[model samples]
Target: MLVTAFAANKTPPPSPTTTVNHPETRQIHLKPINRRRILTSLAATITPFFAPRLEVNYEESNLVTATFLPSADARGLFQMPPPRLSNRYFLVRAGESEYESMGIINTNPVAKTSMDNGLSKIGKIQTVKAALKLKEMGACDNNCWIWPSITQRAYQAAEIIAAINVVNRSNVVPEYSFLDARGLGAYEGRPLQSVSEIYASDVVSQNVKPPPISDGTPNESVADVFVRVTQLMSILETQYSEDTVIIVSPDSDNLTILQAGLVGLDLRRHSELYFEPGEVRYFDPSSIPKYKQPASALYKCLNPPSCT
Candidate 1:
């Protein structure tokens, strides 16, 4: 009865009289089941999935319990852990570009390199004034670096700054992409007045990306640019200490966004901290008000899905 019940679960066997498929179908050999080994195999497979999870939870509890600050209870109160900046940062907005004088937006790399679209004559004068201002402030009295966007206008400004500040050409490092102007996506080459639409979207959320271009130019969100800027900050903090860094940008957006992050302002409102062409500001982290730190928590990402 037991054998009949066990065999009932498998495919029906051919009758003893049936010889048609006997030569065609090959018999599969069956090994006797080892209950202990099977159980051991399952334990090996399943234990790992839960064991590490349990171990991670235990470790995280010990690591984060005393250190983690919940945002809910800390409302309206200033929190510590300010941005770790070991260098003096002088944020400079490069002088007006030829495109700006023409009332156009030209963020395309090829066009930016062209003299027709690069810095205007007026821009060169503005850059010289900004550079002279830096020299007057004694910004490069100690070790200093002149960092600029790869855009021709910014590079021009950086050269002027290096000359005025007596910094070496090697120290005038041109940032290839991160410090470049915020690409306006499909709005590229459009009238400068069209930028209001981009800022309108930015006022709503930092994650809003501009419409993508057909030429494979990426439309970046404020968050995307923020990530790049954050990476740049990390690199600068790690590589240099107690040095002066002059960060030059082709447009106001990059400098404003960087200032917003450094001062703990909501990134969505970065446009509020605008930088005019040829504007120069010395970034001092210690000067940030306590109110800015506490207000940052209002937009804090505490829970999942609601974070972005």
Candidate 2:
């Protein structure tokens, strides 16, 4: 029976013409998965070897740091000292062209004390001092024909004159004619009365130089001096017509006018108006005699001043 069963199982082998399909022989297909997830997993498996550990300190440490120190002359509460008359000279010169084009006249009206005081207070501050320093440093020369300091001062003076003129025309202030001391001349091609004559005729003093008083004296405060100067400037304004522009030559004369506080002027107003000394090819370095050359590298190393 066993031999017969074996022979029967063997007889089940298929002939060459007959074929049977097997499930294992059929083609198989796979479903797609997220490529990003696979790549992330692969990267995570290899990253630990390439990364480095970093250490940070939480406690404060004493570290010596070297810093450059500026020289003693370079360090001061005021970058530059208060402006003197010399500074205004350049300011007026720079504004001359504009004054001519605008037909600004040098009108000399008597200025009230309050008006003078208001303007003088603005001039004493450090900002004005810094402006004066810049003025001293810029320009082609002390006599810069193009953008002189006197031009800038004249510009400021013109504005004040314009304002006062408007006030007078509107009848806000009494219309009063002071003497014109400018002498008869053509200013910017216009025939005008002299500034000197204006000062001489209407006002008791025509170009009368104020008597020199001792400096640093208690008899009159600097503020009082400013008031007097402003008054003179106002008087000058009243004497000239709106068509005439006062041309103050050279920066020194302009500064003298400013020092007198006659124009309701401030240096800061003209700081950017004119070329500075450094900008100028030539300037009077003697104007600021205190400024000196920096010490040599070796000298500075040997003689450092105390900072504290």
Candidate 3:
């Protein structure tokens, strides 16, 4: 019953959860700017789905980020439908931005350095959590492919698949990449000199535009990211059709693709998906007619479930 996707002859109920929201805080002046970056695009895009004559600001709406609204991602599916849920690709956003202090550039120097201090500690902890979640969600330990961005932050991904196959040790092999740079130039890895050069909001106070993220070329937009991700899924279906490929990538890169994907699908709602520290998501090919598939919400460490 816990894993079922549909209700009995009626619309499924809205999400019910026990997590509590902390009191809203404006303690940091920089906070609102982060919300504005993505929400602005969402609001403007949603207007087209409403009555043809509707208008919206998208900049300041609380409802723009309704996570538990089961139909939240539905509206996005109407315009550009999500890709078929291929069994081979399991997209994952690596644990929290633990490297916020390291300034985002994964140049040769940084790449050679291991994640240090608290980020290293938290990164491993989150990887283990995600490992446990994926197994419980029906993933088999053998023949898994761990794909991660060719950045230092991706060290967490190696640890993740390792945790997934603790007993066998050789169950999965990891491959790091910059989006298949040689052939797939459709989207390129960000080449930032410093973290400040990465996102518009990252250096908003500087009053400068974000430089081209790829060899000084124009940075890819959210829509571009979505297209590239879908393309990768298709390629993997051909390459690893019999195995699973779990992706580990950055937040903005992965989330932007997801947020844009929800809009492309166009179901019925306009909301930002919530991805927290140690978050893991699963999409099963078996769940065809995916617009109706429920979001994975199985939580652990509550009351223990007895072993069979």
Candidate 4:
């Protein structure tokens, strides 16, 4: 009786059935992205990523700076270079170590390779001494490339030209690397007051593109953004033996991108570092450990739906 009751309560199997799929299904297409006129639009962030093989010195010259500063060389209220020029040549792609340094100072417009901001003579002497001292400490090695930010090529040319003079006068100095400033051909433009802002607005804040301007402003170009991020990453991933310094602009987007990459904030919220114009800042990779995920650098989640 119990067995019969259990069988009666059990579920029954139904007869065979046929299923059908729609013949006219819809296909989804993603709208095209307008790459140009976007602020801080790094190459990797946009389409057509960089070449697989990034030569260490594409437009770079060998350069050096110090790992640590001697009290005398570490002068200045904030130990900053003057308002315009980090003229010394330094390696673009360094390594991720405490001993390696990526110095960022400043760059300004120049009419020729031998010009500077002409803003400060005292600043030149101080930076010259500091850059050389860094070379001894194993930073740029005295042969570094003057950074060519869109707005500061001329300024960089002036600073490195000044540093080259110091390398010549000093008792022991590496020959200024890469004889030319790579032609300050692309330095004429309006300044980008906040490179960091562009990234934050577009990548982080989900904002509109800046209005296209033809005037001399640093109209964010895809190639230029790619160059800055790649050069800085090369320094972080492969080059350098210690903490690095950068003679950079107070508000450079390139510098901000470097800082963001280092801190592993791409997938969370965009992070940035703020330095006063001509202010000196020590960038230690140790401060922000590398991301555990090997591809975080490439993934660089700039616009995660939930990322800050």
Q: Give the Cα lDDT of each candidate.
A: 0.74, 0.28, 0.44, 0.34
lDDT of 2 by residue, 180-296 (tens): 112112221232233333223212312233232233112222233234334434443444333222222222222332332322222212111233211112223244223222364
| Top model number, TM-score | 1
Residue 300 displacement in candidate 4 (angstroms): 12
Please, what is the TM-score per model? 0.68, 0.19, 0.45, 0.35
Question: Which stretch of 10 consecutive residues in model 1 shows the poorest summed lDDT?
Answer: 1-10
Stretch of 10 with least lDDT, candidate 3: 299-308
Compared with the true structure, what per-residue lDDT tens digits does model 3 show for residues 270-292? 11343454567664434423233
Worst 10 residues of 4 by lDDT: 93-102
Of 2 and 4, which scores higher on lDDT?
A: 4
lDDT of 4 by residue, 140-186 (tens): 44433333233232244235533643433232222121111111112
Model 1 lDDT tens row, 1-308:
01111232356444322212223344332334557878897898766444322223665465642233344343322121233667889999999898899988777665656776567888888889999999888899886998898888999999999998889999988898888678778988789999889988987678899998886456888888776677677767767889999999998888777777776667777787788888898987656553232354444543311124
Winner on TM-score between 3 and 4 is: 3
RMSD of each: 14.4, 28.3, 26.2, 24.8
Of 2 and 4, the candidate ahead on TM-score is 4
Error of 1 at 287 (Å): 4.3
Pick the lDDT winner: 1
Instruction: Give the winner by lDDT: 2 or 3.
Output: 3
Superposed by TM-score, candidate 3 places the C-alpha of residue 86 at a distance from the truth, in angstroms, of 4.1
